[model samples]
Target: MFRILAIAALLSLPATAYAEKLANKLLGAKEVASQQAPMPIGSYAKGCGAGLVELPETGPSWQAMRLSRNRNWGHPEMINFLVDLSQTAQRLGWAGLYVGDISQPRGGPMTSGHASHQIGLDADIWQLPPKRVNLSRAEREKLSSIPVRSADQKSVTRNWTRTHHELMKAAALDPRVDRIFVAAAVKIEMCKTAKSSDKKWLQKIRPIQGHDSHFHVRLKCPAGARLCQTQKPSVNELSKGGDGCDDTLMWWVTDYLNPPKPTKKPKEPAKRTRHPREYTMADLPKQCLDVLASP
Candidate 1:
């Protein structure tokens, strides 16, 4: 009787829901193994990390936020790079870096929030530089990142500063940085103020939505770890002297930034459809299962 009830309960669930439940079970583990060597597998959007290292919660020139998520883990190379970058920012007269999510211990699809940051090579750095590094855990969670975009989202606000520009520029120029994603307005601002020689670095800063509060940095594939995958080149390759201020920027500004109202039609009852595909253990590289299973 008990076995029959258990089978009936599972039959009541939708097929997609049942699949997601099984995927959750495989990815639910978030602890790192001390004995393994750090290796990144698959692409940034669908990948996993092994032998991850955690960025210190507090550093002389940086502070990691959202302590409860335990999302500060990353490849050792990335951790070292962030430490060096923060120290450089301090020397450049910026107060300090307020770092955001890096990747989970066994870098896989997060339960919520982001589609990337799954390969241990991506990180979000807040627009508001840390005024102090001794912030309590509670304070870090409650602190808000200052938005750089203006009310209309057509330009940067008053709170935007030269220090912000310098900090972003430094990060873009770093050899390991593949690209830095920011708001269109921020990219426009950089294009306007950039010196002739500095225009090259502008290519590395790509504009995207909802980055007014923080810029995302994605690192290039590391020296090793052959199992990892790379994203296909963008339609307009930035490395080929594409500052991205052409039709692409205009599309984002005119279309995405301020889209037209939807055309109203006769009202129709909503229809049920399958949920969009979600990444599961099978969607990731075969080795990721081993990464998740590791101590």
Candidate 2:
């Protein structure tokens, strides 16, 4: 009986350990990639990518006719992303909170330097009104009798700015999202404000430069997107100075980011791949063997 009980305990240990490891793995998952090629630029069929969580086949899924508001083709998971995003935005006090740029319909040279938007999960959002601050209006008014609504309206609504941080935070938290590319300046601020939890989460987003105009958010392909191509994260690179946003933080390249231009031509690989076999004194020519021995 004692030996049998010991054997049973040993068997249970593996199962318990495996369950724990799986839980940890799920929690630590930072990014996911598609297992197949992305759908071509104008395919209307749904489920374009593979290796992602599969979704329903019915109507009103995500990515309906390029605009997210459409009722058809809006998957529940995608809808969940928008819902969570909008809720988070409201909590953070943002306006015109929505998803944009479903795909890179135009296939030529683009500003983002990649075909990230082609997969149909990325989005862009605008800043919220300052009147929607966390503080009470009476107290805020007492401190400064100024209307922030007007100022917010004057600010660019479609471009990148500090106010978009709410959206960045929302995207970073979503498990479905693969990565986000935001303005260099905005990223700098995020790095400064990033908490320990956010710091771990933000590792999934690959920050790059030249995004001040608008941020690019990319999603990992879901199982429903049958032909969607897998997106890979870019390598970390050094940053050149600009607005003096804290330069100490490390950066990863989101799908929308690009490799920095080299200051000069990089050295080319040697064309001759094969080399002569190494020679040993025993195999040396007679003349060379005598000369070498004389030394």
Q: Pick the candidate with the highest lDDT.
A: 1
lDDT of each: 0.79, 0.38
The C-alpha local distance difference test score for the whole of candidate 1 amounts to 0.79
Clashes of each: 0, 28
Q: Write the per-residue lDDT of candidate 1 for residues 1-295, one digit (tens) a residue.
A: 5534544564466877755653334554555543468888888877788887899999988999998877898888889889988998898887678899998888878766787887789999999877788999999889989999887778999878888888888888899888999988899888788786657777779888879999999888888878778767776673577766665467867788788776997578789642212665657776776665555
Residue 24 deviation, candidate 2, in Å? 43
RMSD of every prediction: 6.2, 22.4
Q: Which stretches of candidate 1 lie over 4 Å from their true place?
A: 1-25, 258-277
